[model samples]
Target: MKSNSHFSNSPFGKQKANKDKANSLKNLLPPLPLFILQPLLNHIVSSVAKKHPELFNRLGDSANKVFLIDPSDLPLFLILQPNPLNPTLKAYNQNEIIEHDTYICGTFATLMQMIDAQSDSDALFFNREIRVSGDSEAMVALRNALDDMEGSLAKDVAKSFGVLSKPVLLAMQKFSKNSGKENG
Candidate 1:
């Protein structure tokens, strides 16, 4: 039998790659205190929500649901309440437990794929690349809302920081393209 370890397409190999990628990313991302990160998260979320009010239109009743967005490779978790009138997104340490109506777990790249609308969420879910738990209704509604939205949230997020972010975004884009990794 062929060794699964050598084939990047295999689960074992993919897990190892993800682990290496996570280590590389964690080193680059500063270990900022949650207090500092909280305000940043709040501002970004507020900016995104305000800039794209239509994102919550398909949410309907599910707009009230609390969502825990966990990037498995990261040390922080984001709890989001997609209320159009009063949206809130807060960050918490990975060790902290919080109440949420729905939970979506995936790697940073996987979540980026969703944000960029580069992948079909259902395919990702079926492929076991992304995991969803808790209220299925809310998950579906949220996915629908994301699907209905135009433009990438990533660009909007970068724009939220004003002119200063544009160069950084461009540089990151250049690096990602040259990173050799498929999802970079």
Candidate 2:
């Protein structure tokens, strides 16, 4: 079986090939430069801070912690430092090494749904759809903070960017709903 694993018809072979193709495609696409993307990220955190001050407050001591949000399907990674006085979200290349208190890995849709309280974080983690490491207590605090809040954080995130907010938010909702992780 191992010797014939390269056969395209084999399930293992097909999965491997698809994984390789994904990785190859990822390498071909460079993430947007941080300098170019940082302003938008800044606006997101700032707007969220202003509109939902309780979010950081809910984070308690974890508010000072740094988080690396890694979306498996995207070519970029997001570094979130939700410090109350100086909160920030920044983009980085997938390979960029950065210091962070915690790492949250999942698909973009899953992360968004989790933030919006549309999906069960435990189910997502148990099912291996989302992987979290480091600062367990802080991660819990962050989750609790998001859960404690009302309203759609995702919608607020869209609202941070002017003009296309509504459509973008609708698209996000549709995307997450169709993402098929709602049960989780």
Candidate 3:
């Protein structure tokens, strides 16, 4: 019998599937109020803070400044700042234009790659794949702090889930490798 794998694997089919997934995500992530979102962001940041105190400490002055992250594919930006009274971080939003002091703009995948250390910050900035504006000094400090990390933040985050961390990480790795092979 002849194989019909070619049909399901067609480029048009793949494009449509990707578009559908994107639409679904967009629908799911509709603008959320900061009050409702604060706890979740705090929890995630607290977990990271516990794992790496030095990282936050190294942020030092930079932590005092508000850093805005704009995911190119999303409608809103994320504002991150280290809590003044504690080591925890807080995320919130404000009006569109000048609400933020600095901006880190990039696609979600690009952000993930940065966190995973799969790509170099200098190269990404040079290629214009990621853009930073306003408060270049603070941005540099933030970048340096991230570059100094001992391991992938993505992996660290996965491992935060207790016993399922390993399995979840392995599955993510396998999926990433397989997807790369498929696209390449």
Candidate 4:
């Protein structure tokens, strides 16, 4: 009788390994809870407004209306409402604001990029990455505001997620590599 190989006999073992690898990758992704993040984002915007009021005015004039859509939520969108009359710079989540002429976007990263580039709205739209419904002028204005705010926006976003700490980010990367090794 010929000796059988242990590895060849168990197909389930390979499947389990694959599943574990997928789980590990899932765990490696940064934990970003939008509910907690929403307020932090608001604070960052307020901080930018305070630190550079001119930038805020530029954005306000250029992007009179803006919408942030959650990719996880698909059709649902979050509209940023910065009270023009209020000094405190309050941000509201009003559904009605979505009806206005605005730049509709899916993710914060993409939105940051839009604000940074100030002229990629058409590109994003062509790629189906962003969907704008009305007012080209408003879109242009929104882009300009993003340009003005680009300097501090990225840092503020990173800080909001606690990734501003280099050590912590490095540690997480190391942990992810180790976990990948174990899974492999």
Q: Largest TM-score belongs to which candidate? A: 2
Model 4 regions lying over 4 Å from their true place? 1-35, 59-76, 87-98, 116-119, 150-152, 159-184
Q: Where in model 2 is the C-alpha error above 4 Å?
A: 1-25, 171-184
Pairs in steric clash, model 4? 62-141, 62-142, 115-146
Tell me the tens digit of each residue's lDDT in model 3 across 1-184: 1112332343323233234335544445655576775775676677777777777666777777666675555444566665435644444332233244456766666766776789888898998888776566677877777777788876886678689789867875765555344333
The TM-score values for the models, in the order shown, are 0.74, 0.76, 0.66, 0.50
Task: Rate residue 47 of model 4 by lDDT.
Answer: 63
lDDT of each: 0.70, 0.72, 0.61, 0.45
How many backbone overlaps does candidate 1 show?
0
Candidate 1, superposed: residue stretches over 4 Å from native: 1-32, 170-184
Task: Using TM-score as the measure, name the better of candidate 1 and candidate 3.
Answer: 1
Candidate 3 regions with alpha-carbon error over 4 angstroms: 1-38, 87-98, 163-184
What lDDT score is found at residue 117 in candidate 1?
A: 88
Task: Give the total clashing residue pairs for model 4.
Answer: 3
lDDT of 1 at 39: 78
